[model samples]
Target: MGATRSHRIPRRAAHPALAAAIAAAALALTTACDPVGGLNSAAVAVTTDQVATAALQHQHVDIKWLTCTAHLDNGPRATPSAGSATKDVADVTCDGETKDGRPITVRGTVTQEVEGRCVKGDLTAKVADRTVFRASVLGDCTAPAPTTTRVTPAPGGHPTVTVTVTVTQSFQGK
Candidate 1:
């Protein structure tokens, strides 16, 4: 009997270089499609300067104030009243996006009072005329009121003893 003959096609091994090229292309495509990669593009909108306002309020107190005056602690000496306070603070700013792709900036400040003796060494501490405090997207502008202590020698007539106290800080978002 004649010898039986068998025939089969040989399979070629995958090319290492081809595999590397394909992997690199896939990586490049993935990185290019990332959403954050085009952050500088025109499609990314930004907000502009915006203004906002807020009010400051007091909640509690420990010492008796002369009156609620703008001075840190100035009031009528004859009557015991809560003193008014003007806090040194800056405005706040924020960036936001609207549903329709509009950019917005929000800025605001709060009016509040501080507690303490109004007269100290004849130098009364009033709220600075300039804005010294500021708030940002990640910052706040609330500052405790600054106070000074008044020292008066114990005298035979009406004598005043002054103690330093911080005023309450309050805020209203606007």
Candidate 2:
């Protein structure tokens, strides 16, 4: 009988540029999809703007600039509760000056909603050591119900099926 020989195929290495590009794309996707951090920043900005607006309305003399800051009370690791995903909270402070050079200040705490997008909280604005405005703001984070889709092959043609599910989240506020 004749001797039998085996031959093996060689594997090729990935190109360095291609590999780098893939890594960069992955990193970008990871950062962009960070729900918690993104939500926190957005919530803070919105809350600050709302507070400033309320203060302006109460003062009715804002002719200068206003700045606000928020300090997270629960930090990043805080988890939402089982019944309600209300966990993230921040203490906010704002300062500005009116056209007449009067000092304006706002203070409050903001709470993140279950959906992780909207917020609800109460804020108080003071002008020159006098309380001028106080109110509570609510953000609507209602999401639609989940939807499912199924695809089945024709009878006796092939025993194959495909299923898909979709979920969505949204935020609304004044």
Candidate 3:
């Protein structure tokens, strides 16, 4: 009788280093390939409109605008230290009753700046006189730097090419 031999299958060991690199690459690729969501653009623009309309209809309109900023002195490897920011918000609450107790209020917000540079978009509103209310302002100032990729020239006499890209939003808001 002939002897039969069984073949064994070989399994490859998982490399954590390779896995991490792949994950990072995937994250970068997804970010770079993704487009800015329209919903967010709508949100930024909508905030302005909400304030504008509220000011016009409400008796007392309180207008608030906040400005925030984030600075990074280090690359991805190190944590960044945040600096104190100046207030860019303006609060204007229109009370229908003034010193004489008349009725009228105008609430609104204007585009602001961070450390002196204009940041958030424009906003404005007005309400009937004699109305009373409070206002609030809020903002964030974290701007993400664009990611770049360098390409090497094939074998020909080609120069290196650098591409500017952003995978995900550096900042977000409600």
Clashing pairs in 1: 52-107, 52-108, 65-81, 67-82, 67-83, 68-84, 69-84, 85-114, 90-133, 115-167
lDDT of 1 by residue, 81-157 (tens): 54643333222222333233333333342222112101111111112232322333211223332222233323543
- Model 2 per-residue lDDT tens digits across residues 139-159: 334643112222332455421
Stretches of candidate 3 exceeding 4 Å from the true structure: 1-46, 52-82, 90-105, 108-126, 137-174
Residue 92, model 3: lDDT of: 27
Evaluate model 2: give its TM-score: 0.46
Question: In candidate 3, what are the lDDT values of residues 1-174, reduced to their tens digit?
Answer: 001111111123224454334433322332322112211111222232323333433443232221111111121332235443332233222222222333333344333422111225322222333334333332334433223332332454322111111122222337
Cα error, residue 86 of model 1, in Å, equals 3.1
**What Cα-based lDDT does every candidate model obtain?**
0.21, 0.44, 0.27
TM-score order of candidates, top first:
2, 3, 1
